[model samples]
Target: MSFKSIVRELKEMRDGIGSTSRRGGSGSRHWHSRTKSHIVPDVTLAPLEHVQQGQWANLPFDLLVDIIRRVEESETTWPARAVVVSCASVCKSWRAVTKEIVKTPEQCGRLTFPISLKQPGPRDSPFQCFIRRNRETSTYLLYFGLVPSENETDKLLLAAKKIRRATGTDFIISLVADDFSRSSNTYIGKLRSNFLGTKFTVYDSQPPHGAGMQLNSRSSRRFHSKQVSPRVPAGNYVVSTIAYELNVLRTRGPRRMQCTMNSIPISAIQEGGSAPTPTSFPQIIDKHFSPSPAAKGKGLISDLNHATLSEVPVQSEGSLEGLVLKNKAPRWHEQLQCWCLNFKGRVTVASVKNFQLVAAVDPSHNVSPAEQEKVILQFGKIGKDIFTMDYRYPLSAFQAFALCLSSFDTKPACE
Candidate 1:
């Protein structure tokens, strides 16, 4: 039937049909009559005009469950979450839909994944609870990536042990291998040999290198160290041989292991207190390690070194500091935030309850507030291209990210 009809029916079901009485109206009481009844005493039956726009959570549990069920099974899934998240902000019913989406299995999934019932639920909090719970109970994939460094081999081994202990089983851990693979193996093997009782399987991840990973380790007993000369054999291990970092794996499963190779610049390494944390990294092309000749081009470089521009130049709104901080990635884009991750493959519709978000643009529109919203609304309708449209909501990645020449072309400059 028509949505209006459905709403009308729902309202009647919520209140009652044909019941009427004198009720408040304008500045005084007024009497109304239903087709099946008369009213002159106390109150009147008046359906809320905005009932259709009401919170889905306020709907009967059975209907809310159905709404959430449809949402979860869709490939673009809802996070097993709660409704009162910011995505609910526009209205009361929108908030209800958000909650219904959370409590439904289509969203919560086969795992009744325990939430820390003590804490207040957060808006767009992310999959932290899911990751933590799976580690404790699920046989999911893991990558034991560690930058090669002074104590990296040992550190990686320790991390594996921790994962194993948390999951209560020794999981097959993998590492990267290349020309340095043999040498790296020797270092890693030394660390693994130190573990006791924890059984682990080792697969030499060479030849068919750069393999996709599964989450579980084979029975530890399957790991047979080869006899090198009689007593010593090739150490059992798995390592990656890829160029990109894919901490890249399914939200679940064993084959999803990835790590960033050690990439500390020589400049930082030799500079001692200057370099960040990693201990080992293959040499990279950069202005220092490998500069492009001026003959090549004024702006061109030999390699994809760090960005030439050094800082974010935009002046942040002081009151907006909290908003930007709340909405932004950390200083170095340290770890991509929840809003930045695109909420997986969820679909985009102009639906009231969408938690699926597009990138938040840094507002740079040097325009009147009306003009800014006009631009923002225009882009908001398309669901992406925030800064290119307006910077108020889609902000700079911090002023530091806005200074580069490439960033100069942004449409509405915030200032």
Candidate 2:
């Protein structure tokens, strides 16, 4: 059977089960409620419920696995790929089988779940994404699919709103565009820059690794509101740092920049080397299940309190570092009288923000010449308020988005 047909049958059978449960006595209704209570009431799983005697939920184990495996293989893109997610959400047994069948983005070269945003991109080529900017609100939206026309809409992977402060500037990123507040459950992470905007730090809402929550004294003083969920960590974990070289004199032809991905190791650039990829999401207090709006806000409010107003520290050149990215120099185009880097038609228009990134090799490490030539991430303008961002393995969408947002900031010293 076709994947959609099988999904339709599951839904139709669920309706029958619901009708059966509703017509039964109070005991049957009580049992149905208990079953739903155990399942996470998220967008993916809320539609289906379990029943001990339901024929749909009792499909043969081997057949059920095969069907879902086919669904995963058939539907490979978003909106359509959501069916695969639905198959997993059907029941506990289905979820287990589906999880086993699904592979990480690095392995499959496809984004299948929310956790994929935190995982590495495909190994061979960079995953392509685009950003839409709302100039009036100073917000940026990141989409997974190709660049859509003005009227067309694509899947919004992440959003960020720019906020200026007396000390520095902040870019508040979240899953939803409307609500940019740190007190919202959709809040993911943020980027903070010093007054000059030359240095920026990327913060993750959860730890990059499996490290236990260790709140520093600095963070304790910042978070005045004691109300916070125990499940949520106390402070945002520093993941990476981005820096722009001071170019006030305009001696350089183009802007020079560098980024140190603290969460990724330098060894990742070596052949057959792997970087740390988070397999699952952190324990987030689901806003949908919260008893009250006020209760949900408390847990979400603790994220941005610990940001440092001073300059984000730059890793010393002498110290052993994680993966370092340096901007590829653009040659002066004599014909156009403008700087240029071969974006291969991905970029158009001459904007100072246009640039490509390649891994910087350390003298101590033996790195391949081909690896150094590969463009790990590249960002440039395609239209007004629209841009393309392509990133490869060792860099997640979250990290790539944060890095692109840095280019949007006004760097007085690095113009």
Please, what is the whole-model Cα lDDT of each candidate in the order they appear?
0.22, 0.72
Runs of candidate 2 with Cα error greater than 4 angstroms are: 1-4, 10-55, 149-153, 210-234, 284-320
**TM per prediction:** 0.15, 0.81
List model 2 lDDT by residue over 1-415, tens digit each.
Answer: 6756888876666556545755666655543443332221232233333443355477889999889888889888765676676676567677777878989999999887666788889979788889989999999999886675565536667889999999889998876666676654556689999999999999887666532333556554644444554334324667789999999999887889999987787777787677778776543432222322234333443333333222222232222467899999888889988887999888876788888999998667788988888999999999998899999988999999999999999987998
The window of 10 residues in a row where model 2 has the poorest summed lDDT is: 308-317
* Residue 376 miss distance in model 2 (angstroms): 0.6
Look at candidate 2 and give me any clashing residue pairs: none
Write the residue-wise lDDT of candidate 1 on 1-415 in tens digits: 5534544444453333113222333212111221111111001111234533554335675664454454334423212221122223223454345434544221232111111110112211222111001234322211111111244221111112122243222332212111122222211211111133222222221111121222223322222222122112223323211111122233321111111111111121111212111111111211122111221112222222211111111111121111111111212234542222232232232311112112222454222333222211111112331111111222111111111111111111111
Name model 1 segments beyond 4 Å from true: 1-58, 75-94, 97-415
